[model samples]
Target: MSWSITLTVNGEPRRVELDDPRVTLLDLLRERLDLTGSKKGCDRGQCGACTVLLDGRRVNSCLALAISHDGAEVVTIEGLARDGALHPVQAAFIEHDAFQCGYCTPGQIMSAVGLIGEGQAGDDPERVREGMSGNLCRCAAYKGITEAVLEAQRRMGQDGWEEAA
Candidate 1:
């Protein structure tokens, strides 16, 4: 029973045909759309490596079924750039050296973007840490990640970023 789903991906409209009810958004993004930036750290959603923006909110793609997101907007790491320019969050991550092995970078960036987009960027390190605790980096680059997100909030002129939680 194949079903059709239309979703805005990375600001682009995408229509896909899917049949398997068990097919998750992560699988569809990686296997079908070839958007492999989001990693599959833990398929059970324990790790935030599969994080993506669903309607401007952070969600674990691995835990979301493609069929369930029929008309939702999805933003992957590939969609973070515009006209050869990096997003502010991406630039901040690079500038802050927020990643080590880079495996968790995409997720971290996505999560950060969500936090900022939701007007949660703030100066409170503890709040930032608590909010970003879902995304784990095996390389233990947490300090850099926190710094990058905080810096991005500052660069974006986003108020209350210093008090996000």
Candidate 2:
């Protein structure tokens, strides 16, 4: 049986048909939607490579069923930029060298975005690290990731990004 789901992705409404209910959100985004930024690391929730924003909250898309998120709003790394300009978090990531292999960059960015939006990514480096602990970097890029999150938080604060809705 096929199940159809409607989701607002990257500020655009998308209606997707799922031939299998077991299809994960990560698969839906990468395979069907052509949004391959969210990687398939462990194919399990242990890795944050498939992190995405579901209704403004970060979730492991690999474990999220596409059919269960009907009418939900989803955002991937592709949606973080506007008019060819990078988002604050993306910019900070670049400035701070938050990535090495770049395979986990997209998920890290998305998780950072969601963290900042949730107002959990505070100014403290320890706090940022704690909040971002879920995202593992095989290259040991935690320092840069923490720095990026802190810097992004500062930049966003200056840019008048009030608490995320």
- For model 1, give the 10-residue run with minimal summed lDDT: 156-165
Q: Please estimate how well model 1 matches the true structure, expressed as its whole-model Cα lDDT.
A: 0.87
Residue pairs with backbone atoms closer than 3 Å in model 1 (clashes)? 121-161, 122-161, 122-162, 122-163, 123-161, 123-162, 123-163, 124-162
Error of 2 at 65 (Å): 0.5
Error of 1 at 30 (Å): 0.4
lDDT of each: 0.87, 0.88
> What is the per-residue lDDT of model 2 for residues 34-121, given as tens digits with 9 covering 90 to 100?
9999999998888699999999899999999999999999989988887797888999999999989998888899889888877865
Candidate 2, residue 20: how far the Cα is off, in Å: 0.9
